[model samples]
Target: MDWQQILTNVAGEIIAPTTAAYALAAIGLNVHFGMTGLLNFGQAGFMLLGAYGYAIASIAGWPVWAAVLVALACAVVFALILGIPTLKLRGDYLAIVTIAAAEIIRMIGRSTSMTEVTGGNAGLAGDGFKGSFQELSPLPDGNFAIGPWSYSMNLSNSWWVRIVGWALVALACFLVWRWMNSPWGRVLKGIREDEDAVRSLGKNVYAYKMQALVLGGAIGAIAGIVYALPRAVQPDSMGRPMTFYVWTILLLGGAATVFGPVLGSILLWTTLMLVKTVLRDVIPATVLRSEQIEMLGWVLVGVTLMLLVIFRPQGILGDRKELAIDVR
Candidate 1:
């Protein structure tokens, strides 16, 4: 109800570490779906593996570097396993396989038998894992303000995550932009437009597909590690909805553009938070329950998405040429 509080929420959403995490995931999605023309509907699976791998390694007393290595390794392995069998399949088969694979990973995390390792449905606590990372905070414990924005190291205490997360996002975006400008990146675009033409030109289409899958999955895994660093690694957090949200961010910004994911994430989260804030303030509690107000916020988001697609299918930053995909 407070206008100042609502404005803060809207502004903070774009700068939040969570937004950076989603931006990283969307960047990975851009590599697969945007540049490579690969339909990866199970990005959440990549995140799940990365998060759990890091958490498990930490619980096993692994150092931060080793735990990160294990997470990236798990993501690559998962991509290979998933891509080798289904990358060659045509017509939404990859999408189906990826979605199923994501669900399978989630189920594995939630399985009763893996409780000791995965923490079952309750998920793994970071108390045993976050020490090494938290110890590396550069900012001294105190309150600090940067112009209009205020931060407290001891209060909400997410300044460290924000610093690391935004740095990684910037680095990831730079790397993606560099890769997509190379010759190898051209083949990815070719495969997306017309795989048959690319294959006829003697290019290894399958190999390229596999490579894209691996790279994107690996990035997704890194995003997962970033995501989990600020919170507990929960299996449910890496579900289908998460993948959809990543897709939304990618599509909203302009899928094939180098900075689209970053822009899209900022816009999408800002709008979502803005809507939630307005709805919670404007809507009377007597008319709608708290949960219903939340649902209405999402509904408004869906309506906005529909309007965007109808008016500009290429997205806010996407060129029509970049969206010329051959579905066959």
Candidate 2:
């Protein structure tokens, strides 16, 4: 096995734009599940909408800022549509609704009828939308290497994307930290602990829930935009599986903790990259095909996650008390 190459790949994953995108998504989910005890199984829907919104608006001649605003607006609309009628339902019911809603979005995006608008299954080419964002990069154009990693400073998947993606993550972490300590965050915690007690205290529980949903959804949309920065906006890529992955990342890092999502994202991607790289190098192709190797890597990762959940349900930084929820 080329151990140096494996190390390089793993190291690159630590700061990849994809990692930052997942981190942002997990942090958004943290706001919903960890802080407010809301069960949102459709975060992927938020992300998909954001990606589509940005792509469509950009294609329609909107400026970058306008496209971004359109993405956030789409998220807000989706949250309202989901939260208005279902926030009062049981958590499990909400989860079902959310997952279904997300699937609906993916199906719609992939439907042949919407091909002209959304590019259907093919999706919009990244080149069309990424230019606006790339043009905003202040980094000098050249091969910039940090240790084992090197790439264009201003092109797609470049340092500029990494910087912006991680900067958003840092800003998100700071905001979450600040919010969790404020009076509003205290009320969210109260709702998480006991809805009846909070409701009796005259808190507008519904309003707060709606607000949390919108905030988290907007963040998820931002994640989708980030994820699309280096690639096309394929609807299938942000389906139910995406939501599950975000959930896994959130839980792995420690839900309710300020930095749990970021920590979890870093660990999960690096670990996956390391496992895949080592397996590909050490195992011969005749023994295992590339796709099989990929599956095997996920199997190993899944087993590890199962063990972590079995032994430490509270996750790496989460408290058991914070995760306690009365689904009823």
Best by TM-score: 2
Question: What stretches of model 1 exceed 4 Å from their correct place?
Answer: 152-157, 325-328
* Local distance difference test values of all predictions, in order: 0.88, 0.92
What TM-score does structure 2 among the candidates reach? 0.97
User: In candidate 2, what are the lDDT values of residues 1-328, reduced to their tens digit?
Assistant: 7788888889899899999999999999999999998999999999999999998998887888999999999999999999999999867998999999999999999999999999999989998888888888888889899877998898888999899999999999999999999999999999888888999999999999999999999999999999998888999999988999999999899999999999999989999999988898889999999999999999999999999888888789988767772333
Name the runs in model 2 displaced over 4 angstroms. Answer: 325-328
Which residue pairs clash in candidate 2? none
Per-residue lDDT over 178-249 for candidate 1, one digit per residue giving the tens place of the 0 to 100 score: 988999999999998889999999999999999999999988998998888778899998899999999999
Candidate 1 backbone collisions, by pair: none
Lowest summed lDDT window (length 10), candidate 1: 148-157
- For every candidate in turn, the CA RMSD to the true structure comes to 1.9, 1.7
